[model samples]
Target chain A: MRPEIVMLALAVGACTWAFRALPFRFDLTGLTPEGWLSRLLAATGPAAIAALCAVSVLPLVKGAAPPAPLGAGLGAVIGLWVWRRSVVLATLGGALAYGAVFAL
Target chain B: MGEARAQFAQGMVAGLPVVLGYFPIAFSFGVAASRAGFSAAETTAFSLIVYSGAAQFLAVALVAAGTPLLVAGFTLVAMGVRHLAYGPALMKHAGQGRTRRAWIWAFGLTDEVFGVALGDLARGRRFSEAFMAGLGLAAYLAWVSGSWAGALAGGGALAAYPAVEAGLGFMLPALFLALLLSILSRRQMPVILIAAGVTLGVTLAVSATAGILAGMLAGALTGALRRATA
Candidate 1:
């Protein structure tokens, strides 16, 4: 990357680090010690993982006909069900399935 | 100081993937901006100033279409309104920061970045300013790097790779689906479907952006109604 780009990258990296590193503790102070906040944070990783899979279906229908949504939908269901283990698989399955539907 | 550094590190680790993702997107943005007749410096400035992905895409597309700057500016401001929510939601988590500082950081918030930051903050994990900063910094670097890379490669050549292009385009929608699924329950499916239907209908009648906003509103309203009825 060019020097300017490199510098910009460094700045972004720095900003992310700062946000992640804020000093306040997650205060689960009451009866609900593991408060809503804690639960929400915990959900972040799984949510991201699921999103990675869910997004795969989107691309499959982009340039194709509206009926292509059928293939995309089926692919997402199957992909999420069978390849539930892998985010990449989930994504790939959706796209490939949609393509297959269009081809046929 | 020590606490800030530790939090920053945590943020860095958490934000690594986001940073990686931003690089190519930014690179593409840079290329697009440059092709639309912006200088390299101007391209970088856009990223530095109005860094939201969708808005950036719209800006470049509008400029390329020869839309006047005033129109582009208004469109961007309208599109960027969604980001305003980040400030109120995140302010308490950032500790005793001034409104100005919060607003500045709020401008930098993206869906992914906010999702990651807010989730962590809500959990009461001891905030590390450094970790948060590190994560943001990583994403920022990736964007700048990606933009520069895109600028160098030229738009025509980049457009030729259809698969990569399509895959990238799909990323946001896929992410959205995943989010919807995460919150989806058997009881909530109907409400979501209704919202989605309404959104698409509205979008067809108005604009795609309007559809997105309408869908979100409809979805939220349905959820609230269900809660009240239940």
Candidate 2:
């Protein structure tokens, strides 16, 4: 088996176990509502998600120009999501926009 | 119908939206993994084992970039760390003193599942283990099946219509954009903006994995400081 596969399995397994075993309530009880840790935890979800989205969309490959189709598609997705509040609508709109741009 | 069966049925009904949303995203992951040179088996394994949309996508990118296994593994963990909050928020509903059942249900606590379960709770439904299990199982099947179908179809589709392949590549980014917009709020604006900026800057300077970690830390610190002063 490949070393990377093993590492992936172990990492995922550890995370799953941690989710089940960790004492979240006990830990939170130690902090006030306005405490730094509480605030940090509160922010982690949005921050991590935004970071993931940015990295995913940004041009990462060296010397590879940003793909216009992707940018347009992402814009469509954001616009549709804000306008409609529907993930399905946004995804479909983005896909259509991307296909349109790709065909051009 | 038995109470457990009824709850399970309700769970499945509630999970339909999540299942629909996961299909295209999972399919896109399969296509991206294939394009990144992963074997069909490997792609399937990622969905079955990791069972995380963002983490799986990041894993493929990290592997394509030839990152070290250890670094890649840790990065995936960091990406999933937000799930830790879900457990606490969900414990009152899903945990409910059944340690074994809670652990099993925890395995399926993806972002969408957490949202649905929480929504169910907010509507004054009693937290039923059977309900959560049914919801999780349905979503899991959709994800795994979608990945398999995509991996099998990706090669043939790409060979036939390369333009379609290019457009398909945009699916992940589009999906993420939609999710980010869905969760965006005045309270989260500062964190999201800071994180996006930090991620972009660090990615330009260093590596994508480093950029994500740095962004998370920076955003968290900024949030903490803001809260302390308010």
Q: Against the hidden reference, what TM-scores do the models get?
A: 0.55, 0.84
> Once superposed on the true structure, which residue ranges of model 2 sit more than 4 Å away at CA?
A20-31, A60-72, A83-89, B91-100, B154-156, B225-230
Q: Point out where model 1 deviates above 4 Å.
A: A1-104, B31-39, B94-104, B169-230
Error of 1 at B25 (Å): 2.8
Model 1 misses residue B122 by how many Å?
3.6
In lDDT terms, which candidate is top? 2
Candidate 2 structure quality by residue, lDDT tens digits, B18-53: 888888778878888887787888888888878888
Question: In candidate 1, what are the lDDT values of residues A1-104, reduced to their tens digit?
Answer: 24433443344334332332231222222213244443333233222222222222333445443455455745574457354432223434444454455445
Question: Taking the tens digit of each residue's C-alpha lDDT, what string does model 2 give over A1-91?
Answer: 3656756866775685465346433444345768777787778767877888888777623324246766678778988887867765687
The DockQ scores of all candidates, in the order shown, are 0.08, 0.50
True contacts kept of 1: 0.01
Candidate 1 lDDT tens digits, B1-230: 87667766777788776775567557656666776776676577657655666556555655565654554454444334334334445656655543333323444456567767777777776544455556666666676677667766665654665555444444334434534444456655655565567556665577444554455445444544443222
